[model samples]
Target: MKLSWSVEKNNQLKAHPDRGICFEDIVAAIDHGGLLDDVAHPNADRYPGQRVLVVFCNGYVYGVPYVQQDDGTLFLKTAFPSRLLKKRYMGGDDNGKKS
Candidate 1:
């Protein structure tokens, strides 16, 4: 899947200096066989064509929220470290075991 984000979005992500997570990291994690799911969100209507996905990278699981453009490009809305999602998807283990 193709992934993309706007310069303004990039700047917004960069604004959070404490986050230490970037678009590049998200892309790389997705490329590394990240798991995709159709989980429901309370604010799902806010983003048209939105998809909720999670990726495990560098021992961390990230929550990636995005919408797909007509050209099949994934326009990333935002990304953040999600320990709750990690535990839910990867099981409640530190070693990433299915359990």
Candidate 2:
């Protein structure tokens, strides 16, 4: 399948080796979320089982989701590294903590 990386994702892949997640790692994580069927269905089964979550390449966990809407178009919702364990906590409830 063809994967699209955002401008920030491209930058992270270039300047900060530790700041960005690999294409392989992204595939692995997505596989765990059961979203791989769409890719592996017609392909050579490259990604078997993947999950769908936001992806953050700012050297953090809690994926910044790249969602494929019902219309079959793709989009990037979050462009920053995860500031908390989960994206839901990004509701500014950190009390000014830079985490």
Candidate 3:
């Protein structure tokens, strides 16, 4: 998976020395270990057509914010740890067993 980082993302990574989320982790998520969110965030007005990919790594859920460029490259806008795990991705009610 190829990802072009935004300036903010680079800065965020630099500012947070303890956070383990990195380029390699994002690549892994894109390739084989993540979920493509059906919901596109409306909050990111700066990034038009932004999409979110959620990945579970090291017991944490990372929401990777990105956009697909016209040239077909994925531009990674930013990422952060999510407070709640999305139900579908976690095999919750709609996807899993029903009581």
Specify the highest-lDDT model's number.
1
Q: What is the lDDT of residue 57 in candidate 2?
A: 28
Q: What are the runs in model 1 whose C-alpha is more than 4 Å off?
A: 36-42, 93-99
Better of 2 and 3 by lDDT: 3
Badly placed stretches (over 4 Å) of model 3 are 6-11, 14-18, 36-38, 44-46, 86-88, 91-99
Give the alpha carbon lDDT tens digit for every residue of 30-94 in model 3. Answer: 56756556357657676668887777655456677778888888887666666554454554332
lDDT of 2 by residue, 1-99 (tens): 334546676456446543344444554565555232222122224533333355422234434345464555454323324455334533544333243
TM-score rank, highest first?
Answer: 1, 3, 2
- Write model 1 residue lDDT over 33-69, tens digit each, in one string: 7654545553766765677677775577777787778
Summed over model 2, clashes come to 16
Best model number under TM-score: 1
Candidate 3 similarity to native, TM-score? 0.64
> What's the lDDT for all of these models?
0.69, 0.42, 0.63
